[model samples]
Target: MRHLHIRTPRRRVIGALAAGLLCTTGLAAPALAAPTAEPAAPTLADGLALTPPMGFNNWNSTHCRAEFNESMVEGIADLFVDKGLKDAGYQYVNLDDCWALPARDADGKLVPDPVRFPHGIKAVADYVHAKGLKLGIYTSAGTKTCNSAGFPGALGHEYSDAQQFADWGVDYLKYDNCNNQGVDAKLRYTTMRDALKATGRPIVYSICEWGENKPWEWASDVGHLWRTTGDISDSWGSMLSILKQNLPLSAHAGPGHWNDPDMLEVGNGGMTDTEYRTHFSMWSVMAAPLLIGSDLRKASDATFDVLGNKEVIAVDQDPLGKQGTVLSSEGGRWVVAKEMKDGSRAVALFNETGSPQHIATTARAAGLPEAGAYTLRDLWQHRSYNTAGTIAATVPAHGTVLVRVSAGGRWATRPPAVELGLDGSPLVQAGRTAALTSKVTDLGRTPATHLSVTLAGPAGWTVKAISPTTAGLLPTGRSLRTKWQVTAPGSTATGSYDLTLRARYRSLTGTRVESVLPLKATVVVAPPAGVSSLGDLPWLSTTNGWGPVERNTSNGESAAGDGRPITLGGVEFAKGLGVHAESAVEYYTGAACETVTADVGVDDEKGARGTVAFEIWADGTKVASTGVLTNAMPAQPVTADVSGAQVVRLVVTDGGDGIDSDHADWADAKLMC
Candidate 1:
């Protein structure tokens, strides 16, 4: 049960137990180790600097394309140092995967892809270091890298690989969980951790195992930072998904170890500038690593502003180093807070929903300054306002208002982008037959308000006694009281049906402040009378890696290509919000299991190859994987299976990458029980 331990300048030793861990092994003694000397066995402090990591990765910018190259790296490093990013606490010019060729030398050493990085890794590292930026590289714990450009894996050569990185002058290593499988997930990382330490090069160990085995628990003792979510894309869906994933694990970050929500997609044009600001603000509040993924050499003004928000950067680089978490969320609004040094705090009001609304909550609601009135400062707009008691502001649609708070007094202020929320919760879910009652109040003293309620039920369901469906109503006074007799559908799913309520209030000046409430009511729909089975079949698929697999490939292949690992799509399950149902997949890439299937279709030809395999607990466990060995010319569908299996996966080893799968087009895939 390892937990994150924060070392505040005040209570030098806040946790006696952590103090014991520190004392028991002199963990904090090597902070100023000689950089040029033999690497002090790598530690969390070694992986991440006293400051959060700041660097440019190729993922968001190049997306595993030909765009990631030596010139790109050289240009970004120059801008990083020139723009004072390094001086302002940015370091680490990291080159993600795909830089290495698929072939290994006789010594089992990974070779740089001569076509992409013709000058070799040493030259690349020299280039970055010459720019006063540290050089970081990527690898995997398994036999292959996620990109499938078979870099020398740390699997059987952890020690040798670590030494090789040290020899290459690689200052950071993002050791990912590629081919490693089974219950030994941590061991796989631990093996590399120890190996990197043995090199004594002071290489910052970046654990990229994708949040498996709760790396936040002890990874701080091993690596500098750990990715708490699966890899993130530069799209809104991917960014939102990753941010939502980082919300719950907030408490696990502190000091030396930080939760990595993947790289920055700011300035990448995948999302709007406002959305990127929200992304940066939210990540800062989460105390996440600020690795830039966009091409900095040609960043937009908005990107520069977002990446250079001094106030927001302060929160991310706060000495508190404490990660923030979600306090509450409703409709399209979410409130999150981070405890800061000097007992001050930072709160973020996020609007992810459509339509503009006021998102309001108090200090206590933010999990800080409990029971006391505090002054608030808007970090974004740099404004200050003294609320009579509790603080409130009106947020805009798909926007955010960040408030910084201290014990007392006001600070320099600017125009605030105010947002507000309901102080009291509306009637969430009363039994369908039970009467519904709710009280909505305004924190901004807005005048008479209007409220609307919308309810959706089982298929072909209806509510006979309801107010206007597509309309609005004014409130009686400072609050609104409402009630309705709700009836349940006879064939209801016997689960919870979401009920949404939107309240609109007008300020004294007649400005509208809208707030939404979302709750769930359970109907008495009965479940099946007997036990159920999901069946034995392909349960998961990932491209170019492991898990339920589908054919995957990089379009970089000329006639000079051979083979690559099949990376598959990763999945996680949680509650569904009507669009994509969240299903928690227990499988992370590194595990082996039985039974498999893939939902695949081909588009173009080229050398298309895919495989599916599973594992049983014992040796007799049957396993199978299949693929088209040559240029299929056209796309085709395929499947494979085995008997006596526990987990399964499908994969495509070559042909193409990204949305346009050169080898094939993937629709959807799943594994059976």
Candidate 2:
């Protein structure tokens, strides 16, 4: 059996858990216990409060082995107060790793490195206090810190270290977890947390565990804010990937307990200003910590802009700080909407593809209204515009347009809506078979006659209607329509399955809507004997649908689509480019396999429809083919056949004016299989 390891910082863990205890569960929850015993004074939880915490970390500027002094700490403090950052809501001047001596003294006490902090931490704290700012320090939860050099270690010294910091008048502790053992990580972290609580000082705890474990779920029970992703490098790919990881974890964040997705790398010289704005915007939306990980002394004007976008910061610092989620993505265009307090909506349109794309959202989709236009603002450009009843705008390549929506007048306009309803009955198990009974209704409370319904079932499940066996349109009065039927399929695999019912109304307006619900039905089949548990199924990357675009080529070719050399007969497809054909089809391979359904985002830029073909092979035999078609937008993920394909092949034609120069980028080529 493979074991999982987790490392958590002590002060962060404790403060987070304390905040979690403050929230009230739903009506059926048990009554809370009054605090008969107060643990200790608590430090302020950064993101849970009215303003976001601002600070300068040492990692970006001074790595390990940098000298520290009262002047250095006080100099930065003076800059913070001088530049009005503290008045602008920036507090806490933090020192990152590598400030301690090589080893503890004979008494097992941690001491500052004589060469680095000659005056010790107390003098440093006093210096910071004199400048009217709080002082912060760093340490690792593991025996060996991330730094190559071992210094001021906290292993088997949690309680003693907490007392040491308390005695030094430390206001904040930035706890890090690096090079720690798995079994010891969690326990070690908890020890620090409990030890910190034992101290009387109110010190804010910032947990930095590189997100090895899913800390957002439980870190709240321990720290004020905990990192939810791995360390972010000074690169765009790293920044974007980190933000993407934070997207689904939004539900786990709130005011007191935040999901820290590491620190900001905006001022670092790796990304452009526009990309940095997107970075900040997304972070604000995710409500992740805004700890600046750059040198504050010499930051550029553009860097300052990113750190000081008042309008964008407003969303981040909103009293009702809530994270957002992706609603939908189509044709390289995606709509991510967040519900805000005061009955307003925050929406962002992202164009992940190479070309410009138009994106729009309706009030219903945004959970707003059936009527009323809304005021719109372009956050990046800092411009405000009116939006029609339906919000529509064009987004640039690899760019995003974010807007806030509320009731308004004279924005762009769209006609009123046509309502449609889809109904599906829950699935239930009956001995050896699975039964599904469903109904379709024109629940839109309108006098509409024609509506079509499309139902999507789980993979490996076959559907055969037992009653009202026609799969098509149902006609109900303008105000109502209904279609009812029963379905039965037999299988053993049971967990949870998603059922989708799509209703499209073809009228002057041509309205289409979808309804999806989950059915919980248990299966009677038992696992094969001797089975302790089931492991995750294998997934193919090519079938995944969207991935990075390979180089464009005419002659150079290889065997696999994964940038690996494979044996091919006459012609081969390597990455997104195709080689010359000589009597053999272009055979491209996938990264992994044994998947049924996959998302395929094709560039098809050559307008080369029917010129290229996608053949899905399962266990070395062709199972299905997706007919060739050119979709101008390369970013949109298209549904493709992996249905039974263990390994899939994509063959692009080397024929005619092939997508001349534009490179096709596949966002996430993944197989649902």
Q: How well is each residue in 582-656 modelled by candidate 1, as lDDT tens digits?
A: 111212111232333443333222224322111111111223323332223322333444333322222232211
Put down candidate 2 lDDT per residue, 1-673, tens digits, no spaces: 0111211111112222221110000000011112213222233443333334556666655455343444566677887787666665667778776667778889988888667778888888887788778877888776656555555547678899999998888877777765454434457667777888799777777776755555664566577777765555554434544555566666666666677777787787656565577677777776666767667677898888778776666667666766666666644366777777666777777654322345677656877775544556556656444333455554443456676766654333321223222332133332334444444432221222244445555565555455542323433223233333323355444333445544444322343333332223322222222211111221111111112223332221122343322112222233223222101121112223234332222333323221223333433344554443233323323344443332343322212211212122222233342
Model 1 shows how many backbone clashes?
A: 60
User: Any idea what lDDT model 2 has?
Assistant: 0.50
Residue 268 deviation, candidate 1, in Å?
1.8
Q: Please report, in order, the local distance difference test score of every candidate based on alpha carbons.
A: 0.54, 0.50
Worst 10 residues of 2 by lDDT: 20-29
